[model samples]
Target: MNQQYEEKLLNLIDRMVETASDDELFAGGYLRGHISLSAANCEMCGKTSVDAMNNAVENSLKETQSELNPADQLIVNAMWEKLRQEAYNK
Candidate 1:
């Protein structure tokens, strides 16, 4: 992610942190790690577009899906989708 996307993501997370439930907070935090890692990876690979950032996030989430239980996965995926929409659909 570039500066703009990073700012958007941080703003989203800030709002989430302020209003989320305990479970949601956990989910958001977990997703944040994936998003950050994906952004860093994208930067390293010279892919600065928002599309690349989105793809990196999706790939990271998909690759880790099996690590979460069904309920947890559902929460995480929901949060991820929300972030995706806010970050990319704006």
Candidate 2:
């Protein structure tokens, strides 16, 4: 990944960790790792990591959506939106 993309992904993970609810612990952590690894892998492949990470995270969220309680799912969705927006906010 480019430095800028790596920074943005890390920054997004930080923001998520800061604001995520207690119930989001495992999911958020997994999301962070997913994005980080994807970014690092992209650097080796000479690709844009942001888009790849975004799609992976989005797909992961969709699969995990059923795991959250209804109310928690809403919160997760909102947090995901915020993180997504912040990731590209530079």
TM-score for all models, in order of appearance: 0.87, 0.58
Best by lDDT: 1
In model 1, which range of ten residues has the least summed lDDT?
A: 1-10
What is the C-alpha local distance difference test score of each model? 0.83, 0.65
Off by over 4 Å in 2: 2-7, 15-30, 37-49
lDDT per residue as tens, model 1, 1-88: 3757866876798787877998889888898888789888988899999888888888998898899999998998888778878877
Worst 10 residues of 2 by lDDT: 26-35
Off by over 4 Å in 1: none
**Candidate 1 deviation (Cα RMSD):** 1.5
Q: How does candidate 1 fare on TM-score?
A: 0.87
TM-score for predicted model 2 compared with the true structure:
0.58
